[model samples]
Target: MTTILIKQVSWQQHQPELQALRQQVFVVEQKVPAELEWQADDEDAYHWLAYGPQQQVLGCARLLKTGTLGRMAIAKTARGQNIGLRLLQAAMDFAQQQLGLAEVHLSAQTHALGFYQKAGFVSEGAEYHEAGIPHIHMRKKLSPQPQLGISNGKFFVSQHKNTVLTMAQQCRRQLRILDYNLNPAVFDNQALVDAVSALARRHRNSSIKLLLIDSQAVIKRGHGLLKLQRKLSSSIAIKQLSDDTGVSDNLVLADDCGVIVQSLVNPETIWADFNNKPVAQSKIDHFEILWGQANANNDFRLLDL
Candidate 1:
């Protein structure tokens, strides 16, 4: 088996090497115009070069700042050696772990769709021609993401119920949730209640604050989450937003990292980011403002755990 090592190199340092591989695959063999093949983005992209055991460049690729992968080329001499796969994997690993990218996008040649698909990229839209070649746009999510575009009218509750459970399981020292009535399907379920219960007991100083607009729904419908707050009130406290505050969004913050935001009563837009600290912190700050004026739910005394 041929051994190949991939390295992240600068365009200036390895211009000749990078140019050689891309030129062989794109301009010479594939006949992509020389003017179109060499791009200004080449100097700015995250470039990767694969080397053989003999120290020859085997393949090369570049990842743009906007998370687009392009200029991927494997020398004809190195075809079928898995160098392309290795080069692509290294680029994606850097984008996710090192660069903190949420996803990566690429344009795949029509004949190479299967190659990118095997690497977890999904094709989207109709086939289009690029650079006089049949090509299609593809995308692959690299980091943890919330499938937040749930718009099903009748099955909406079940769609994102798992999202709540996921964010809860990822919580560390703090979890803040602001909801109107603790949407029964999403938060009142036993699985989520148990997860939050475990979170409260796992970290001693962990603060789990739930801000609700009303507790009447849980009182009438008998929610397991209501039972949880009653038993773990010391670690997990529930509060009610002041009626006059007029907040109308469902927001959940998990340890200042994960966030879920949705419009309440008129929930047309729902979004979540599991690895965004800045966005989560911003929402938590807003939650704190509401929590400061919020009062503890005295109604929990109505239920005995």
Candidate 2:
């Protein structure tokens, strides 16, 4: 089996490799005009490359600051291996976690519409010609808004653990989490860990404050977020509730824009709001008061293996 690795690269650092892959896939194989393939916007866009076992470039893609995903190409030999999917996912991750964008847009070739659709992209407009190739406007909404509410507000009820984690990734400036025992099942998800790690790495002034009533379960199971808190001590902090104040509601707040609140007694029933400011702010203020009363926890260190 061949191992394939996908990573982000700078235009200046991996110019030759990116150019070679694009030339082979786009210019020669697809017969796209040279002048049209190599656009001036390449310099300003963020680029990514997918490499095979021997470090050979198999695919490439770029993301614009305005959330446009374009110039995606996969080598002929790598077509059936899902390299394009990885490249597209990398672009979407960059747009959300690193750039803090709400959604991603792409001009997908009409024939490849099915491919993008599998990745959650929906066609927005009629097909048109771009550089002699049929193209259509497509977009993928990155943030999940609440499912129910009025014109200015909406509410979401998440029954599964992944839904709550997905909401946490949309957090940009600040994140406040409250739960009982800080259950490893919820905080140990790899995707959620990566999202939080990327957020801390991209935003220097961002804060992630976690408050748990009991951390015995998490400590026994080895939580990834605990390890992350230790590594990013300045940005992430873990605390234990010193009193019984505000322990009934398990919540996650993202800045002043979004919030997820579940009853600690009934974890399955979760209520979240992505657009309502007043509701989110109320939860945030309650969190701050509880946070102030919480005590710093230093027991998250690695245990003997």
Candidate 3:
């Protein structure tokens, strides 16, 4: 196996190398038309070049400003070395860690659908012809938006509300929230209510469980989440922790991968990381113990489904 190294290159500094690689793969080998192959966007797009021994270009891919990833090509000699996969990872890492793009879109050659799918991209719509080749639209959501909030920072009320809502929008399988009171300003918002509702319809096994220290106040406040739960009783469950439970931190877990942690002692102090499975799992494990001991607030039983 050959060692593969990937690096982002500038069109201005590495034009000869970039063009040579693309021309070799996309034009000569694939017979893509020379006129159609060269685009003005090359100069502005983010270019990633994979190198073999002695810094020879092995593969290349580009990400456009609009979050489109394309122009991916691997040398014939390098096809079996996983050079293409590493190059694609480089592009995606840059998009998520540096560019802060919420998601990426690509027109994948139909035959390569499985290749991209292996990297967590989902294919959408029917196959269409592009440059005389069958292609399909595909996209992968990067780590969810309103990204990680460090514990050192204090959030304004609006920031906290927006972050939870944005995180809720990305939930797929399940959403588990453990909070002090299920604050009306954050959990009762229409945006979160709608997101949870949509998630419930996404799968029959989808689950939403909320643990609150106080349910009487939430019910009296006419919370939208409580209302949603009553209407979707089979999909949503709300429980109240007894006073004996020592938990004081508020947590919002999305799909068991994303998390928003807030200090109940200091509501403004918060931390949100949308891609930390370990932290989410640990917090969820503790939450489950509490969830099991917590009583299903009978108040919800009074509302008609």
Candidate 4:
């Protein structure tokens, strides 16, 4: 657990040291062909190097603008303490933050796929050989994020675990309705429906989430939630669950056994059933796959015409 610090390299200052380190690690130790080791594009890339307190290069990685992350190498002295994962994370962050890449791809040595998987990269296509080593192309998608607005003034907000509730008596939360590929009106007339409707009316223009999961085809029907979702109108995002993937939508449903809705003022506070669960990201990933393939080309505003 030795402390390691990473420094962003400035071409004029760190290039020589970086080149020397690469030559030692890639050309000599790893036997990466010389021609492939030094590309003309190195001068334009954002480079980072991890250094011990004495200023020795412990690890390094580079970010290329083409969304290709490559050339990560660590000193032989630092091989087993997980320095590589840190380098990879730094490279991935730079690729997304500085280069604005949507998807980051890496050509990982076959044996190292497990390492990449831990960092959120999935293998693509099939295995191939690069520079006399077995390799696989791996990719990780960066979530599309919006500029987060800062709240200048502190408002009196209450917390329910992570779920935020407004000051309203019966309607202080945003509820995401889960539709199991069915109509949205299945729960409209129940006590759950009346409570949610009253809350929505209280908020007026705030957005409440409704998530639909259609498992009837897979599970052969039993849940009442799935039935309500099928009847809901369009203009809503209803994602289907599959065994192969995880949920893709950050938009999640409520956790109550009955219908769930919360105040829009603290939408981020609502916790889904998967809250604090380790596999929650996998669930969101599953929803994203279905969402990506769903047709959304219609002009939403012109639907009335």
How much lDDT does each candidate structure score? 0.78, 0.78, 0.79, 0.54
Q: Which candidate is the best by TM-score?
A: 2
User: Model 4 segments beyond 4 Å from truth?
Assistant: 146-305
In model 3, the worst 10-residue window by lDDT is 149-158
Q: Over the stretch 1-305, how does candidate 3's per-residue lDDT look in tens digits?
A: 34555677899998899899899988898789999999999988899888776888888999998889999998888897766776776677667656878899999999899999998899999999977889999999975334432222322221466678877887888899887778886788788899999988889999999888876677666778878888887999888887735787888888767788877665545667777777778988988999999987677654443
Ranking by lDDT: 3, 1, 2, 4
Clashes of each: 0, 1, 0, 38
RMSD of each: 18.2, 11.5, 15.7, 19.3
Q: Write the per-residue lDDT of candidate 4 for residues 1-305, one digit (tens) a residue.
A: 36566666865688888888788898999798999888877888778888876878888888878988888888888888777776776676566555678999889988788988988899989888888989999999975422212112222111221122111122344344333333322343344544444555554453344444444442343333323333333312334443223432234332221112222333322232322222434443443456565443222223232
The TM-score obtained by model 3 is 0.49
Candidate 1's TM-score: 0.50
lDDT of predicted model 3: 0.79
Q: Among these predicted structures, which one has the highest lDDT?
A: 3
The Cα error of candidate 4 at residue 82, in Å, is 2.2
Clashing pairs in 3: none
